[model samples]
Target chain A: MKCPQEFVFAANYLADMARSRSLEFFRGEIGAEVKADTSLVTIADRSVETMMRDAIREWFPDHGIVGEEFPVHNPDAEYQWVLDPIDGTYRFAAGHPQFGTLIALARHRKPILGVIDIPAMDERWSGAHGWPTVHIRQGRRSEVRTRSCTAVKDATVFFCSGIMWRNDPMAVWNGMHGVNRLLDGDSYSYGLLSSGFADVIVDSGMKPWDFMPIVPIIEGAGGRVTDWQGMPLTLDSGIEVVALGDPALLDDVLRRVSAA
Target chain B: MKCPQEFVFAANYLADMARSRSLEFFRGEIGAEVKADTSLVTIADRSVETMMRDAIREWFPDHGIVGEEFPVHNPDAEYQWVLDPIDGTYRFAAGHPQFGTLIALARHRKPILGVIDIPAMDERWSGAHGWPTVHIRQGRRSEVRTRSCTAVKDATVFFCSGIMWRNDPMAVWNGMHGVNRLLDGDSYSYGLLSSGFADVIVDSGMKPWDFMPIVPIIEGAGGRVTDWQGMPLTLDSGIEVVALGDPALLDDVLRRVSAA
Candidate 1:
């Protein structure tokens, strides 16, 4: 299934809007409030999401919208735009540059276009169903693909945070012993994987806005993303997410993850 | 105990030399090798250290030099320079921008002047004895200070990695539950601490070159850095290290770390 060119253009435009709005609050004193879930939220997140949502409605009224800061709209529509206006709000609140805006155009619940925009770093990764993953850094665009690492032992893994895994934490920690495990990076980890700088990313407790935008980018880069049980991610998929730059390592990674 | 003006000037010159050389290999392919200690090293690390060492020797012939890649030179000299040309090799090898060059000038074994140069990000933080810490980004220099957060539970902590603690992992892991713990950033984390972006940084298994350069920067910003046992870090200090943006949190942080 080919992704619509218009959707890709819209995603890039939406990301631009998000980058401009979010930069205003970054590094400045933001009025950050603790959400019900204990995660931090700032006015920047709401403002960026609202700006993107309004643009989406004005340009494509029939398109649905799902954002982190607001209620879902047009849930039953064929084309749905998923937005995490500010992913890694914790990093953002801490004045870290790894936070990004995620935008995905899902066609009938399957993502076909995705964008990961790191505003502070001026880096962005965009991919669609039928196109190669493209990384743009400082306005230089180039195609990128995942590197091959068939064995899990030799892989460089990015595990977001150990505490996020509510289930058997020790098992998960021990499973990554032989590998080079970096315990940082949120959505930026996926972009690194797509660019072949990282081999795997294991994270849990993700939302639709978190995981959906990455599926297309990872798949388009010849990588794979799935639930812990090895199922494709959807709007209704479970939160335990595993992404592998080399698709062949899926079974080996899943085996270790299942043991955890 | 004021830092010598000449030493501060020399340290900044060395950092500039490292920045130009390290940026050449960053985000580009280089021959990376695994050391006997299982840490990764590259030509960039060796080259940057060699370049800095040469400049240090030429500028101050009597000064001693200690670096990660090579053996100590003039180890008994009154003035000694400690260097870690590439502080976060894993991130650098993975094309991540958080890696930095650490430089410190110690007088009679006490670090009086220090610099943390992040070449890829074009950011540097420098501090000296009796001087406020200064941060430079894109040629803009500003004096930075640590924000006050005295409580352990309310602090935003940056723990480098979990697996580095060989003695007891679970205890340390559980010790950080109530705080907002971020598991990334190497030397960059310390810079963020000095700039008031983070509250605490806890890590283990650090050598002199790793911990020396961070002391003055943290201390000058009105923060504290010490061994896990609450002792000031010296050339012979233990590898277990902890830093706090607010000095009032030292007792509380050490209590938790000791329990771990």
Candidate 2:
């Protein structure tokens, strides 16, 4: 957590830019294409990515870029901005407003500043290297801190999507369904976690842009985000990720989801 | 579809009342209790239901009342107002905005007027006999219509909660997961279906209030809501239900989900 205040400010600004552009096409008749990876992609995603990349280059020309809809740019730079213009395209295209624009700044392959903005919902979350995490809605902002979840048996968990169950190792799916309350939440679960409204989230099939911005947000709120194997997330972390509001619940959750 | 305009107007007014009452507690610390059925219940739910019941009794002294939080009133009356003060208590208690207050007026045990009001999101959907289905958001109203789904293989389905899969017949869960795409949504999914944003939603463990209002909304939108066996919904219908935006896909969806 060594990023500067300026970068955090810039990340928030970039997210605002992404939000206005996204709202323009949201809930409208938008066309989409099946990407080479089989994920859904709409012009909205590409348009927002381009808008963000341009702004980042203008603000910090030397910073690298890694985004979901485009090729990585300047990969060797020490500081990088990661973007996911539309994190939940299916929900977005389906006219559900939980889709968000994610922005994260990584230094030396570690995320240091992150912002999660849902324009349709008028909600945003920002966390940085040394800054406290905050959740913003409408015009008000409040600092967010995770609540303690001392027992996996009592913790409420949100599985990002049931599709994740299809992707999760069978044991992981069973363990996730075994939680006290396993709800279905897409990216909205992250914001809930940041606010201490929920305790755990586990999901699979994520890209860097999907997991990067979330790291600082959750970590800033005193939570932990890691691959299911218990490794801290990096630009290269595997997609199967687990986040816990209380670090104490990690061993029990990992053991349950990874049981042989 | 034969309800009078006065009835629809009253339902909408009741919804506005429900919205304001629910918001007073949303995202705020509120106490919750475990009901005899093991479901979460809060003062928010009870307060809204009581408010609606008082208005209904005062407005139509002869009318019946059936709400999730309270016992049935005047069960033998020809006209009954079904209410679910907070349809997704888990989500509402967790600070999620997808929960809704459902109000439906039933005649001869068949629902005729329905309102789904999402208090936190400032969104409401009302459908009534002889009235066009419409979605109202932020003081604006728009007619809602379902889209055609010629094939189940190409349809996007929302399973109300992953918890439903645990409660449903195993074959039903497998059938829902086997759909082309599965997203997690609750009462909000019913609204999505009414708007044609999603094609099918199958859920289990519903009470009269949980499934009643949705029937009019979907039907008015040119969709169909029924038991998993495809029988039309009634005050007496089972807890398991299915809604299809395109009635033509009903056969395929039912056959798949009902397979032994």
Candidate 3:
């Protein structure tokens, strides 16, 4: 199934914006302004989101927009674009090179395309529904897929500590007993999971913008991404989610976490 | 008090040998050999450890040698040299460029000096007891310090998955929740905490070589490195450890995890 041309074009354009932002950030001229929540924000986040939102308005005026820095542009539209201008802002602010800009396109309440651009790291990942995922590194593009490691004992779990688990924590903890390790970061964890470095990623307390872009990227890489209850992720959902290279492991994790 | 001249010379020579090994593994000519545990153990691990161990035997005959690859020599000596030939072996094998060689000196059952060398990444970190910690990035040396973020809520927490936390999942999981985010890899995470980019790193199930080099490095950077109960990190404990910028936060984390 071919994705709409606009999705491809917009994703590429966003990647270009990320490159420029990364260059500016490393040049050490701009300061990171603190938001009320004490998390750092920068001019790049605002500028990139503005550029992306403007392009969406011009090319798909009927589509909606939801971003970390901005309110909804058209909350009722069937087609929407979600943007996390800088997903690893803390890492970025601290001069670490693990941050990325995330974007995803949804059609009729489902994500059809996604992009994660880490310009400083010189890596880019893009995918659309039903199409093979692609990674661009050092000006070369290659297909991407998650590894199908079956046993929890062999699995490397990527996790972030900020979110609370409503469940008992014992089952998830027990299931984790089988894991090799757990990493953190919301979308970046998905990036690594899709790249075959990790098998499972569990996260909680996500907004639509935080998760929508990651679903297609992992799904396109031959993995399953769903809410904690094992429900498929949708553009409207704001729930806990787990992405896994194998579907059976996802079930195992869910059973363990639910039991906990 | 100034560190002994012999200790500095020995560490520098070992660091040089470690660099050569890292270069070989990263350059990819020899290729990595997988260990029985499924982790990669390349020729670099063997070659570097051999070079360092040989030097210690010839130059410091009375000292014990505890390393990643070889059996301990003179294990009952008053001074021991601990080694991790290549700390992030997985990253080195996969060409991730974040791996480092770890070397530590312990006298009278306590770490006296530590050195972490990552030749591929062009970074070096070293410290001696009562001496200033130093970070050399791209060949420039700067004094390193722990980050000033004192509260657990305000602190950035890092963990190396459930590998270290397997013994007490609830304690580890709950301790993880006490920090801001969870990052991985004992070698690199400890380096980041010492450099002030992160605060509060905890690891369980660590080997002597894995945890020894990190103790002096973090403590010399004005942070505390101790077992989960806030005691000092001695050699080969294979127990849980916590490294924090503030003593109060460390106590809080230990209390939370112990209760869990």
Better of 2 and 3 by lDDT: 2
* Global CA lDDT computed for model 2: 0.80
Q: TM-score for each prediction? A: 0.93, 0.91, 0.78
- Model 3 chain A — which ten-residue stretch has the worst lDDT? A31-40
| i-RMS of candidate 1 | 5.0
Full-model lDDT for every candidate: 0.84, 0.80, 0.72
Clashing pairs in 3: A159-A183, A168-A260, A182-B161, B164-B204
Per-model DockQ against the true two-chain complex: 0.40, 0.39, 0.20
lDDT of 3 at A81: 87
Compute the lDDT of residue B23 as modeled in candidate 1. Answer: 82
Cα lDDT tens digits for candidate 1, A65-152: 9888889999999999999999987778777788899998888898888999999899999999998899999899999988888788
- Give candidate 1's TM-score: 0.93
DockQ score of candidate 1? 0.40
Model 2: per-residue lDDT, tens digit, A1-260?
A: 46798998889888888899998877655422221112334578888999999999999999899998789999999999999998877777677777889999999999998898988889998998788999999979999988877877667777666434553334455675545465565567888888887888877778888889889999999999888789899998876778898889888878775672
Across B1-260, the per-residue lDDT of candidate 1 in tens digits comes to: 89988888888988988899888877665422221113335567888999998999999999999889899999899999999999888778777888889999888898888999989888999999988899998899999988888688888888767334565565776788888777664788899888888888888878898899899999999999999999998777878899998999999889888888
Off by over 4 Å in 2: A29-40, A166-179, B31-40, B162-180
| TM-scores of chain A, one for each prediction | 0.94, 0.91, 0.89
Q: Write the per-residue lDDT of candidate 3 for residues B52-86, one digit (tens) a residue.
A: 88888899999999987878889899889998888
* Clash list (residue pairs), candidate 2: none
